[model samples]
Target chain A: MSKQGSASALMAEQSPGPLVAFENVSKIYGKGDAEVRALNGVNLQINAGEFVAVMGPSGSGKSTAMNILGCLDKPTSGRYLFKGVDVGGLASDQLAMLRRHFLGFVFQGFNLLARTTALENLELPLIYQRIEKARRRAMALEALETVGLADRADHTPAELSGGQQQRVAIARAIVTKPSLLLADEPTGNLDSARSHEIMQLLTRLNRERGLTVVLVTHEDDIAAYAGRRLDFRDGRIVRETRNTGKPSHAQ
Target chain B: MLSNTLLMALREIQRNVLRSGLTVLGIIIGVAAVIVIVTLGAGTTRQVGSEISKMGSNMITLVPGGDMRMGGASGAAPPFLAADVEALRRELVGVSAIAPYAQRMDQVIVGNENRRVNIVGTVAEISVVRNWKVTDGRLFTLSEERSGKAVCIIGATIRKEMMAGMEPLGATVRVGKLSCEVIGVLEPKGQAMFGGDQDATVVLPIRTYQRRIVGNDRIAQILISGADSADLSDLKLQITQVMRERRNIAAGERSNFSVIDMTEVAGVMQTTIGVMTTFLSAIAGVSLLVGGIGIMNIMLVSVTERTREIGIRLAIGATEREVMLQFLVEAAMLSAGGGLLGITLGLIGAASIAPAINVPFVFQTSTVVQAFLFSAAVGVIFGFMPARRAARLNPIEALRHE
Candidate 1:
């Protein structure tokens, strides 16, 4: 039994499949007259260690696709597979387990708990993961150091600047050592200089850590940083671009 | 997970001190009210029971014409005669002693000191039946009592008021128009439960009192003392039957007189107080429900205000159960904390007010624990809807809520 378990564990570690897949997925918001087709049978695949950006206008359903990819919402009539396991049939708790083990999220507003220190905010995910206090503290500090905000671990969000808060939010996202980092307009609230700093951090993290990233942004310069890009329009991916050379907007 | 949730709940409550305090006010008042009312009720019942038992152990009083509890209005119904008392003594078994007494209010002059006091006229057996002792001098001799001598027994209050520093025994005091010698000073009996001075009266021979005071041989009350092994109710029944025969009352008609057992009176008073305590506590419990509603209201507002926070948590992989547990824990902590505070306040309130109301401060550990658990349950019951609302929020919409 132990030998079989070890064999399966090794196979799971080197699984030969796409990390995420959307097979003709669709999401409908309402019924009949008020129906809104948020995703229209879109198909996509993302492998390990890839930095991808999704770009679209306000009503083009890019956010809906991100929500589905993040497992925050289920597809209406199609399958979403994560690590070769179908997610549409999973219960809510199982979906939560998937999110906890594999996904990390960073929002546009830098959603750190207010009035809480940066270290505590970073420990939030680890707490949910049921990690012990000593290890959780150490991991949170390590994540803060990775985001270059270890000195500000004791400072509350209200005491930090917008870029610093975003850094804390990024540290919280990576604190659990998740497989995929999901960032939606992570630099939307920052100035140009702060935005450049955040982008540089994301790019370095993607390259150095080989962390898979799925970022959704509307700005052309923001999307330019990713190695691959997809443009959405009218609930469908209209175009895909690959950058084999250096990023066009690199410093 | 539960501890982490509880810690988070504590942090959230601490973050909004004023709001949390206001939310728990109803629970505080409700719990405090329940504790105070019930404690005082128990104290009062205990006080009444002890005081009544102190009057005489295993004693019963038969009043002519009416029930003692109903003011004993001896207006038209005939007074009990001496023959009725004699018959009870002779026929009733297990009766240790019996004393028939007639009382009248009259001025008793002791030189410069004079006071209007209740003058009790009864047999020498009254000292035995009432368990009264002569602290000084001696009780009337059998010959003195049989010949109707004008010898009196002054109670402790009379001794303190009329005699003061002087020795009261062997002193002569004028009772109404008649002169009486003070034969003894009765032992002090403090205040009665129903609010009369038990030691303020003077006692005299019944024959002398009948001849000089009222000019009649009528007896107003008969006090009976039963043996330690006697069944008081059975003795009371036998006495009632004998009295019915003596008065020639038919079996179907209600007797004009009443027999009161002290223990039964104590039981009735305690039961009545227990019922009142339950009733008042129920009213106070209603306030606890209102407090629970307050917690629900605040929790709902918190959920709405923290919509984006909930979204962030959901996105970061908190389960719906965890989210609900967070809110429920917050509410339970608030109510339980309030209950604790109320217990302390109620106990203090009861203790301070007990002396003023002449009752002992009484409380039980079970009462405190039950109150605490009950308040916690109130939080969970009332907090379910709000916690469910928080847990069921769509992450997308919650994230977008302003």
Candidate 2:
């Protein structure tokens, strides 16, 4: 409706200490006889520094919800706000700028450029930010160190193993120091042992830097690593659980 | 940001080295063809102009035929007579000097060395009209022209070949059956534009030729020079009309003689060669268009091949404009690189071939720059489709593409 989001909306969002809030958001796909609702009037809020795991079976709108949170997709209807600023009406370029300054993404597959070295892959996002080369290299190296892959910076993704490649992808994601790291099934392609290693790394990032983490995973064990969980079923959040599982090593 | 995009484009081109080379090949051949054809055409055109001017300008030749360009008589249409030459001198408005001309092939013998030479018979006016400079001795005077003396002027080819170490002037060389003294040695003139030795000829008084050699008063050609201030084309038309009147041809009837203006001939030849050159250049441009299509094809393939890479760049916060610019730069580089190669090839080919045919290698700088610009244009025009395709791709769907 182009109205300024009411101050009550701010208070309501802040009640959950929200860094990200989705209000009655919906996403529909296809048209007419083939129409399918991906998400329907979903309302949710995740506060600052919260590592929230989104768990749902396929077609349950968990991916769609995560997509909207990352500013990668727009809702068909309703207001989605990031830090109390409406993002639903922002242009595509504005969304890109938002992602450049405030967001990072990690994918299920390590999507680092195939021909580039791991260090160059990590420097990719910084290139878009127009950061100077020397400083971008330093930032990339620091991100690699945080992921414990500093020694593997020169190796290509094809040259590295799956776990090492995923680490490189994570390094690339956080190289720009984004406040909210959106991870879509980050451990989906890894074995359990490597999955736990990646989960530990994500938990460390969330705990130490207070980086807001929104992770999508179908695995319950992967969900357990988060401080909170929002479970989806048939385009709606069916349950919210404040985790009582092992404390993700309780930073 | 621009530098980043340029580097990215370069990296992509380097990654697909074979495809890039194949893509640029069309531009190379296209641009090279255009340059080489146009450069050589220009050189030939210059050569033609210089050749025509060498023969003489502001001079008109009256041939005894309806067509002036045909070298030979058109089926015996009555060769020009001395009376017609006199009438031309008296009736034509801008006539400055006129010569009655006849020519034949003769066997000349001197000191047991025999050579066949072209013998031209004309008046003393030839000296003034044709710019015939005598290097050794003086041209025959008007008295000697009327006296029917067996005096001749020899060109450089015969002076060097037959006389060799002897002084050619004042030496008598037997022509046909009569002995004639070489009174003057003409200056050396190089080969003609259409390919003949211009210096291997002889000139003698027309009266002597008519009385002794051909045994007739019939003139085969009449050469006239217009006054310094006269327009040669207007003079030519006036001569044509006067000749028609003198020949007693009826109105609307075709005149039997043709007045050939050298300047007009030069202009027509220039225009014809210019059109031919442009036509050939246009044919060569087709290949450049094909080269552009080649760029488009390779760019499209490149876009599809790098779909995931594009998605990754977009997801990492690259604007669509940046992505499009990257691909555009790549295309421009390919075509521009090909353009440079083509120019090099064209110049090299011209430089090597020009001397073999004895024409100057004329490199038109504007042509080179134009070809380069055209190739760059091809890149931009052809590269846009693929670039737009890449730019318009949805980030999510592109990332999801396998």
Candidate 3:
């Protein structure tokens, strides 16, 4: 019976499709002489439960890619399939629905609503889902507990430290139980020690909750924490690597 | 969705308190001004109507015309004769009373005090027809009127002015070097509907005024009072017929003397004031347009300021309709709040000023409610453009905005 359960768990893990897939996506900014290619012919696939980091210098299209993956923006061309659904042809409302149902975004600045408490920020996605108040509060508290921010749920973003605020932002991102998480320069504003702590938290969420994280960053040290890396330059992916070593703190 | 939008709007307004307050002020003043002006105008009309009503709804005035000139002003129309008054009283079925009156403005001297006062000459029945009450003493007798005796009735204003500390009853006052004994002191009537000082006058018997002051034996004008039970339109027709026949006027020709009905005059005045109020309110409505423009301007700024926030919301699954509704609700709330406050302030302002200017204060519930609704409509009309712009914002571009 134990052998059968192990085999079924392995199958369950393998059965879940790629959480996010980009098929020859290209985003062009303007026409002819004023033309700028924000994302030029990008193709990538991220499996469920994988923690992937996208690293690129300025003007390298990493931000543009992150925006498209997060369903914040539509690609100028090519298909973006989020959880096997073609997202390229989706209307603005449909895109929003996709984002609401399957995607969660975290920004580097924490991007917490300045005056709102951590609990309210966490409930924002549920508000979009039109969830009832009592249920939303319970879900928000559960998410806060997941992020170890339950005690500080009532505190506003302004009252929180940089690490605590980012945790609240993470709680907000995951409160909806989205299939994919997109973090753009999540620890760019934090010091090295704080950045390491945030990376550790992301690793824990990836391992325990089995959340698929696609983090965009410029830092090499930040990318080292991820199990897979895609590096970009001049709006195109230049390299891809699998990190076979244990994460820096894991050693 | 609406509640979420409302929450976002409230948060935005709270974040920028001063700008929101300023935006609402424009609508507030506009609505308040409209309410105050409309209320005050209505109050003034009511006050005028009531004053005219006090002078008797069935009263009519007949002015003099034609030859037999008195006091020798070369071929000028003479004063109305007693025959005209007699014909009106006898022939007209709806006629209740006739009082032939002659008026002269002259300096009246009562011992040490002297002042210019309007002196009216008419029979004692004039007081009843004109709705004038005698506060003290008695009206002149018919014998006194026939004999051209010097008995007179003085108004409260004239009595106050000429006799000051002394009681005016039985006091003798000289008008144009003729002494007349005051038989009664008329009550204070205040300003007439036509802006005349009704209280600042002296009344004497018609014969006495003609014989002693003007040195003529003719009436200046005839005051006609209709029966209380008679319809005013029917009475007017009857009076017109009697006067036309009395003067032998041909068909299609206008009557030489004008017969003015107090009720008709009052109606005309009310219609005129009503039109004026409408015109003034239309002009005041221009302020609402200005207020609408102000709202649009502020909303435009708000949209620009919150473009990033809008992007964030859009990215998080807020639809264009949600964003549009958010800003639209904010604008509507601003104008509606302003309108509510404006109506309250306007009523207070109108009520405070109406009595001081001798105008009746009227609080029209419909007008107040209409003003409030108008302000809400203004918000909607003006807020649409900015809200549309906000809703149409590209999430990616907006998020990228610094």
Q: What are the per-residue Cα lDDT tens digits for candidate 3 across B144-201?
A: 9889898889888887777888877778888887898888999898876546788888
Each candidate structure's TM-score, on Cα atoms with residue i matched to residue i, is 0.92, 0.89, 0.86
- Candidate 2, position A38, lDDT: 98
Supply candidate 1's per-residue lDDT for A119: 98
Task: Quote the positional error of residue B40 for candidate 1 in Å.
Answer: 2.0
In candidate 3, residue A247 scores what lDDT?
72
Model 1 per-residue lDDT tens digits across residues A1-251: 34334323433675688989999999999999999999999999999899999999998999999998888899998899887778898778777776776888988999888899999998888888888999999999999999999999899999999999999999898888788899999989999889888988999989999989999997888888899999999999999999788876677
Runs with alpha carbons beyond 4 Å of true place in candidate 1:
A1-13, A248-251, B66-73, B108-112, B133-138, B160-163, B170-187, B208-215, B250-254
Per-model B-chain TM-score: 0.90, 0.92, 0.89
Best by lDDT: 1
Interface RMSD of each: 0.8, 0.9, 1.4
Candidate 2 off by > 4 Å: A1-17, A148-155, A244-251, B86-96, B108-115, B135-138, B159-167, B170-174, B250-252, B355-359
Best by TM-score: 1
Candidate 2 residue lDDT tens string, A65-176: 9888877899999889888778998888777777776788899987889979999998889998878999999999999999998999899899999999998998888888
How would you order the candidates by DockQ, starting with the best? 1, 2, 3
Accuracy of chain B in candidate 1 (TM-score): 0.90
Candidate 2 local distance difference test against the native: 0.86
